[model samples]
Target: MKKVSVIVPAYNAHDTLARCLGSLVNQTLQDIEIIVVNDASTDDTWEIMSRCEKQFPDKVIIIDGDRNRGAGGARNQALDLASGEYIGLVDSDDYVAPRMYELLYEKAKEGDYDIVDSGYYQEATDTARLYTGDDLTGILDDNKRKKTYCRRRISCYQSF
Candidate 1:
C-alpha cells in the first residue's frame, strides 16, 4: 500500500485549489496518494481537479460527486477508495509544507503510533496565527515545546 493517502474535499474552491494540489504533488515523501473529491461544486473546481489529474496522473485520484455531499460525505467517499497505510486529510484551500508528511510518517514509524499530529497557520490580510493540521503541531518549538493542545487534528492516521 502507499505510505499515506491524503484526502481533500473541495466545494467551490476555485481560487486556492491549484496551489494546494501543487504542494501535495511536490511533497517530500513521494509514496503518497492524493484523493480529491469535488462535492458538486458549481465553480471551476472540477476543471482544476481534472487538470491536476492530467498533470499527476499516477498520484492524484479524482472523485466527482453528482450532488452536494458536504465535506464529511465527500471525505467518506474518498475513504472508501483510499489504499494507503495511513490516511491524511487536507482542506482544498489549505497547502502544507513539503516536508510535513515526511516528518509525520517518520514519527509514526519511529514511535509505532497510530496517529501523528502537526501544526498549521491561519493567515489573514494582516494576521497569521498557529492553528492545526496532520502534524497537529501547535508546536511552538520542537526542542522546547512542553505540551501542545491545539486542534484535534492528525498529521496522518492508520486505517487499521
Candidate 2:
C-alpha cells in the first residue's frame, strides 16, 4: 500500500471542516497521514480540530499558526510536516469521494507518470461527462505551451 500525506489548510472553517475530515477518514486508502495547518482561525475551528485529534490520535497532526497565515503559508507548514512519498492537498471546505485517493494512486502507478493530472466532477446535480485526452493547443492563446506547462496551476480553484 502506498502511503500518502493529506495536507489541508484551514481558516475559520468550522462549518465545513468536519465534512472534509469525514471524507478523508473514510477514504479507502487507509495508510494516510493527515496534516492540518490551522491558519489562526478566530472561530471554533481549533476546538473541532482538537476533538478530531482526540478521535484519531494516531492519524491526525494539528499545526496551529500563531497569526493569520494565508493559504500558501499554511500549505508550506504542511509541506514541512509531510512524510509520504505522494502528497495531496485538499481545501478545508471541499470534500472528496472515499475512493478518490485510492483510484488516483492506482492510475499514477499504471500510467508510469511522475505526475498525473486527472479530471473530477463538479459534485453538483449535473450529469457526469467523461474527459478524453484532447489537443488543447489553440484552446487558450494566452501563453506559450512550454511556459504554461512549466508553471501550471496547482489548484483548479485558484489562479496561483
Candidate 3:
C-alpha cells in the first residue's frame, strides 16, 4: 500500500479545523498520516488539536511552530517532516470527500505520473458540472496558462 502525507497549515483556524480534520479522519484510505502545522494560533486550535491528537495518536503528527509562519512557511515545515511517497495539501478551512485521496492515489499509481491533477465537480444548489481539459504540457509555464485564461478560453472559473 502506498502511504500518503496530508499536510494542513493552520493559523487561528479553530472554527474550521475540526470539520477539516473530521473529513480526513473518515477517508476510505487508511494508510495515511495527518500532519498539522500549528502556526502559532492564539485561539483554541491547540486545545482542539490536543483532543484530536489523542483520538488519533498513531496517525496525527503535530508540528508546533514557535513563531507564526505564513501559509507557505508552515507547508514547508510539514514537507520537511513528511515521510510518505505522496504528499497532499489540504487547507484548514476546506473539507474534501472521503474518496479524495483514494481516487487520486489510484490515478497516480496507474498513470505513473509525477503529479496528477484529478477532475472535480462543483456542488451548487441549482447546477453542477464536469470538467475535462488538457494537462499542463510542462511545469512553470505561466505564459501558456495565463494567456489561455486571459483570453477567456479556459473552462473553469478559478483559472489561476
Candidate 4:
C-alpha cells in the first residue's frame, strides 16, 4: 500500500491545476498516491488531469464527476477510493512544499497519532503568512482550536 493518499478536488481550475499537481508529483515522499477528482469542471481541468494521469501512470488516479459536486463531495469520492495508510487533502488551487508530506508522515508514524495536522502558509502576490496552531485559536472553531494547538506542540516537524 502507498504511504499516503493525497486527494485533490478540482473545479474550473485549469490555470492552477498543473502547478498543484506538479507539487504533489515532485514531493520528497515518493510512496504516495494522488487521487484527482474532476468536479465537472467547465474549463480544461479534465484535460489537465488526464495529462497528469498519463505522466504519472502509477501515482496518479483520475475520477470523473458526472455532476458538479462541491469540494466536499468530490473529496468524499476520493476518500472512498483511497488505499493509503494516511489521507492528505490539497485543493486544486493550492500547492505544498516538496517535503511537507514527508515530514508530516514521519511525525505521524513516530507519534502514532490518529490524526496529524500541519500549519499552513497563506500566500498573496507579495507576501505569505504562516499560521501555527497558537495563531489559530480565534480563527478555528472551539473543538478544532484545541486540537490544532495541541498537535503543534507534540510534533516537531515544520512545513513551508
Candidate 5:
C-alpha cells in the first residue's frame, strides 16, 4: 500500500497545475500516490493531467469528472478512492515543500497521532502561520491564545 495518498482538486487551474504536480512528483517521500481530480475544467487542465498521468503512470492517478464539481466535491471523490494509510488534501494552485509530507508522516508515526496539521505560507505574501490547537498555549498567553484560536480559518493542507 502507498504510504500517503495526496488528493489534488483542479478546476481551471491550468497555469499552476504543472507547478503543483511537479512539486508532488519530486517529493522526498517517494512512496506516495497522487490522485488528481479534474472538476470539469473548461481550459486545458485535463490535458495537463493526461500528460502527468502518462509521465508518472505509477505515481499519478487521473480522475475526470463529467460535471463541474467544486473543490470540496472533487476532494470527496478522491477520498473514496484513496488506498494509502494517510490522506492528504492539496489544491492544484498550491504546492508544498519537498519534505513536507516526509516530515509530517514521520512525526505522525513517531507520535502515533490520529491527525496531524501544520502551518502554511501564503504564496502571495510568503507568510507562514500555524493552526490554533493544543500547542497554542505555548506560543501565546491564555486570553490571547483563546482569541486567536477562535478566529481560525480553514487551511489548505492536512494529513491523517
Candidate 6:
C-alpha cells in the first residue's frame, strides 16, 4: 500500500494542472500515490493526466469521470480508490512544494497523530502572500484520534 494518497479533483484546469502535478510527482515522499480525477473536463485536463500517468506509471493514477461531478464528489471517488495510510487533497490549479508531503508525513509518524496539515501561499499576479500560518509542531502530542493542524511562518510544512 502507498504511504500517502494525493487526491486532485480537476475540472477544466488544463492551464495549471501540469504544475500542480509536477510538484506531486516530484515530492520528496516518493512512497506516495497521486490520484488525479478528471471530473469531466472539456479541456485537455485528461490528456495531461494521461501523460503524467505514462511518465510515472507506478506513481500516478488517473480517473476519467463520465459525468461532471463537483469537486467534493470527484474527491469521494478518488478517496474510495485510495490505498494510502494517509491522504492529501489538492486543488488542480494550485501547486505545492516538493517536500510538502514529506514534512507532514514525518510529523505524523513522529507524533502518531490523526490528521496533519500545512499552510500554503496564495499566488497573485504580482506577489505571493503567506496564508494559514499555523505551527503544527506545537500540537504534535495531541490525541492521536483527533485531527491536528500545524502553522508556521515559513511555507515548507505545517501539519496537514
The candidate that achieves the highest lDDT relative to the unseen native structure: 5
lDDT of 5 by residue, 1-160 (tens): 8989999999998899999999999999999999999999999999999999999998999999988889989999899889888998888988889999999999878877656667788767777777546644333568765665576554556666
Q: What is the alpha-carbon lDDT of model 5 when measured against the actual structure?
A: 0.86
Where does the lowest 10-residue lDDT sum fall in candidate 5?
131-140
- lDDT (C-alpha, whole model) for all candidates: 0.81, 0.72, 0.73, 0.81, 0.86, 0.81
Model 3 TM: 0.79
Off by over 4 Å in 4: 125-160
* lDDT: worst 10-residue window of model 2: 151-160
Looking at model 4, residue 1 earns an lDDT score of 89
Report the candidate with higher lDDT, 2 versus 4. Answer: 4
**Which number leads on TM-score?**
5
Score candidate 3 by lDDT: 0.73
Write candidate 6's Cα lDDT for 23-94 as tens digits.
Answer: 899999989999999999999999999999999999999999999989889999998899989988888887
What lDDT is reached at residue 118 by model 5? 78
How do the residues 60-90 of candidate 2 rate in per-residue lDDT, one tens digit apiece? 8898988888988998988888887678888
TM-score of predicted structure 6: 0.81
The total number of steric clashes, by the backbone 3 Å criterion, in model 5 comes to 0
TM-score to true structure, per model: 0.80, 0.78, 0.79, 0.82, 0.86, 0.81
Better structure of 1 and 5 per lDDT: 5
Alpha-carbon shift of residue 116 in model 1 (angstroms): 0.7
Error of 6 at 106 (Å): 0.2
- Clash pairs, candidate 5, are none
RMSD of 3: 4.7
